[model samples]
Target: MLATPPPYPSTIVTSTNHPEPPQITIKPVDRRRILASLAATITPFFSPHYPHLNSDQFPHIPVSFLPVANARGLFQMPPVRLSNRYFLVRAGESEFESLGIINTNPVAKTSVDNGLSTIGKKQTVKAALRLKEMGACDNSCWIWPSITQRAYQAAEIIAAVNGVNRSNIVPEYSFLDARGLGAYEGKALQSVSEIYASDLVSPDIKPPPINDGTPNESVADVFVRVTQLMSILETQYSEDTVIIVSPDSDNLTILQAGLVGLDLRRHSELAFEPGEVRFFDPSSIPTYKQPASALYKCPNPPSCK
Candidate 1:
């Protein structure tokens, strides 16, 4: 249903990039869950409401709630449609950014070194206040932020302002992480242009690896992951408002390009600044600018890169 959609509304906010996934931690199994599962099975078998029902179907195989159709054909994805309105927020400036250094390395994502600075915090707070003013929080909403310290900190500020529950503030690891700079780890902030230069040449290009501290990423690589994130969100939610917080601009820009049906190579032109917020129409066409074959890769990205 999306066709030549209108430009999204952009408001001041606070944002960064990609590369590595956060370390995973497994949680201990809950005994209560096991008992609950057993009770569901036993009660269903004995309840008068279903006295003759098949016990073999004890654990119901939840049928797909979404309608199925072949109109789009087998390899083609449905239109870029979302049940809720999404507001994209770029995280505020970080401590390293304040020093003119670029820090998208996942190893330091949680370190205070990559966290927000005074100006950045102010930016995030202002953006959150703006969202509150917009009535986005009148009903329940969810905030999804990159795992980076800066992005998560911004999420916290929004939650505090809107009174959103901490449980709804989710940390996005794969799709929303700052773009990794690989060997460019401690380089000057302006060095990001060097990476984007390669990206324009081909989305498959990667930044040089000094030693894989944080491998670099190609625009195409980011396109794939962000597309995955969109797929998940579109399928799981509806009639809701989801705030996407990123520590850098590249990921969000790439996402916007995909949303608006622009060429992937043109993504840099859509650069968004830190603490900026924007909204796009989900019914837009061409959700992802997928190519015919594999080309560039990622391991990176920096905002504006």
Candidate 2:
């Protein structure tokens, strides 16, 4: 969201969930080259022919946030000093996702047709029960779900299980929607790799506009809005747990990447399966970590392991 970074205090603020986020390495990450080299490894996930391939099929090394999205981008954004705990979650799988198709149009996504399938409903209920087990919403907690029907429904389920007031459950319309697949809407689900492939190149690159439908988006497009959402949450709440329910994996991953100060381009590596719950407990933030050299008598982080 910002081109020029804000003031730095010699040390960057990072999320508690991320002890060691991605950092610049000796060979700077070249997006085009990396994607080209990783074709055999990365391309198959989006190919229907490779249905057996796992979403996380390989050992993921962190990549630099270089394919600059928007002239000024979000990679430069430092983590916020959170006054409250935050939990990032994904809604259950949608009909399109289970059907092996795509849909990002706001109009269609909110409809009953694109809502959660039977499995999705179960998954959402299970996630809500987990939150209740953790007692995360027993106190003054707030719930924010994206505008997607599935996410909103998931929020309701969580509230129902934890006895949260309906008023405390808010619907976030903009920031946490599924990453718009743009021209790829209604296509095979595997087509998502095409969007991810483009994302590896730059955040500003919009998907090709097709027949006046859900316009595709660049990663930075999501970054800016997610940033706004985080700012609002941090500014509005304090010392309480705030659970954010997203309709898709990308929104949670993207938001986590930004909060933990990882290279925005490598956001996909921080994935969340449907109905998964992960949290950021700012109270657990450690003031610092000893350098590897000091810990294991090694010269660097990679050497320590």
Candidate 3:
């Protein structure tokens, strides 16, 4: 039998407009103990069958075949965790013709009216309602920091539509924010594409040059950060579901990384429209060498294709 998890530290704070702020509970795991148990159980299962299999035919033996200490060490490493289900949603569209341009352009201005258009808000609400109908609202919601205003607003709408309190919404910075576009910000979508034509067309990963006086992050940087975050989330919420709201380009990058295990250079192959939503199982993500084509084979909207 599994031991009971220790009570996690939780606190409640009151807001001026609302009686209470959203509640956040964090449960810490005993990594060493878990790894030890896993190694012990897995070793015995594989030990009896090893001699029956041909090592020459199967060059990559299971981790369980390793010594107990080695197995434990491998299990204890980072970026490995039990699988968890998650939902990814793109933020509603703003005035920008294409994604990322507005964020990259320092001169561009954003306000309640211009940031999320009326149609964008409606689409987000509809997407949230669809999730709620599908029982996804039971899980906590996480939104990207850059699009907090619109993302949180959509979360609030979701909570209201689901007849649940809005305390489950949280903000995360792991999602690639538009500011990473640097000099591309504020420029027309076509102009930005023209500037980075070589980078976009090249089969190899070629990160765009950083513009002066702007924060710049490459596709690889975002991939690494998001993958680390996925490892942590899977471990912490192994049996629970969660939602993530982010921008289109950022969402596509994450989806491509998770579904195909492709390098950052292939990020353009996958795309997402504003307010689009998709389901994913973080634990089952395969490596690039083991491509899972079926996961990403579904038809997409015109923009996504």
The 0-to-1 C-alpha lDDT of every candidate, in the order given, reads 0.78, 0.76, 0.55
Per-residue alpha-carbon lDDT of candidate 1 for residues 1-305, written as tens digits (9 for 90 to 100): 77873343323222225545444445567888776655555554544355544437545622222122223222223343556788889999999999999777788899988899999999999889988987777798889999999999999999999899999998888789888777888899999888878877877787877664786777888888788887777656667889999999999888888777677777888888889877766666555556645655544555332
165: Cα error in model 1, Å: 1.4
Best by TM-score: 1
Models sorted by lDDT, best on top: 1, 2, 3
User: Per-residue CA lDDT of candidate 3, range 1-305, in tens?
Assistant: 99876566665566767767657677788998677556654554455344344444544555455543222222211224444557777667765543534454323323453366677788788877777777775654433323445555665665677665555566554353443565565565655454345445543333355556445555555565566556555545546666766644554554455554555455655566777777765455553342376565546755454
Backbone clashes, each candidate:
30, 2, 3
Q: List where candidate 2 sits over 4 angstroms from the true fold.
A: 1-76, 281-305
A best-first ranking of the candidates according to their TM-score comes to: 1, 2, 3
1 or 2, which is superior by lDDT? 1
Give model 2's TM-score versus the native structure: 0.66
Regions more than 4 Å wrong, model 1: 1-78, 283-305
Winner of 1 and 2 under TM-score: 1
